[model samples]
Target: MLIAAASTIVLAVVVWATVVNTEGWAAVQRFFLDPAIALEYLSKIWDGFLFNLQVLAISVVTVGAVALVIATLRTLRGPVFFPVRIAAAAYTDLFRGLPFVIVLYIVGYGIPTITNTRFPPIVLGVLAITLTYSAYVAEVIRAGIEAVHPSQRLAARALGLGYVQTLGRIVLPQAVRKIAPPLMNDFLSMQKDVGLVSILGAVDAVRAAQNAASQSYNFTPYIVAGVLFILLAIPTIRLTDWYTARLRDREQMGSIV
Candidate 1:
């Protein structure tokens, strides 16, 4: 632990020294770290960040529900369900392979063009996030479901449990434990991407920072916005690490040498 701390301090000092020694360091600091500009724009950027949180809250619920349905469809057995599984697979493959920014553009721009109606940017952002992240999350859930031993399903069937009952009671709980870490990671990614609503013209944190930068010609607001996001993610990041460690310990408790 002492060695690790010493190495981290040395790395920090080296990085600081290198950055401060640069010829453009003064200009860089003036543009990106001006305390006055950051303070001036803090409230506006925070308001915009609140919009990001609202979008994230809505997307989380929708993504979980939609992904679960798609996963269940993918996991269904027998030739009769082949078409359903294929459709689900196609959806996951298509969205997973597409860049999220492209998906955002298609859903954000294409929808209004086709329907001839304007939707709010926040609404469009949530829809794009849902469509894209649901595909990624569905695959995670499907893998979790499949990771359960086949014998568990067989035993549930022998006890007269129906398919849905068996899944809900005997499978999903275990799958959730196994997949929680990855799911949290996806959610962390989603939280950051929620700021992309600015592309659709929403006055989100990123947009607010852009506006501030335009007015002051200083990039400090952008840095402030980024710092805010980092601050927001810190708790979730720590929680994910703690939970992953706890889960690993539990799994290895009896078998550890």
Candidate 2:
């Protein structure tokens, strides 16, 4: 009640101040509430949004597959496999340490130059997002693998399961389940970070907004693009919250049973 009362009082004061301040009212609406351009932006930005969705879908799959390989490599044992482990560690460290934009530049522009190849900008966008995000996802999967009880591995071996079988049958599954929430978090981050492909000149939502704004010299297009992203993101956000809460409840009760 106290918190609600305080928030209401603050909101009332802010609204009153805005209503009385003619300059502030005009400025806010000029940037954000331009009805004349809203429909124009809505039509153009949706085309770009579809491209964003395409890249996101492809990047998610690429990251998932590549991350599992890297995570498995990191968990390898035996002196003969030492080089493989070091290589995997180096990959994760190198990509994770670099800013996503730098990685995007390297893969998006550098690869094309080196290979004398051309891919549509959306392909480059997915590749860049996949490369950067795979490293992080590998770490998440590695943590999940580690969180599986040591005893499970021991039990699997006692039943004559090989190391590969033990890990595949026993550890990775539990790790994935344990790390689902964190993985979802990275997925959400990827949804926004996909926007960085604007640097590559892909006409995704942000790029569409930029193109629209350039013609008219108003920021309404950017606002529309942002609103589109938020609208798309909200359902996933709510699902994540509900899933996280259910996980907490299960943990507190010590299992679904």
Top-TM-score structure, candidate number: 1
Q: Rate the local accuracy (lDDT) of all candidates.
A: 0.96, 0.89
**Best-fitting candidate, scored by lDDT:** 1
Clashing pairs in 1: none
**Residue range 131-188, candidate 1, lDDT tens digits:** 9999999999999999999999999999999999999999999999999999999989
Cα lDDT tens digits for candidate 2, 55-140: 99999999999999999999887999999999999999998999999988998889999999998998899889888999999999
- Single out the weakest 10-residue window by summed lDDT for candidate 2: 18-27
Off by over 4 Å in 2: 1-22, 254-257
lDDT of 1: 0.96
> Which residue pairs clash within candidate 2?
none
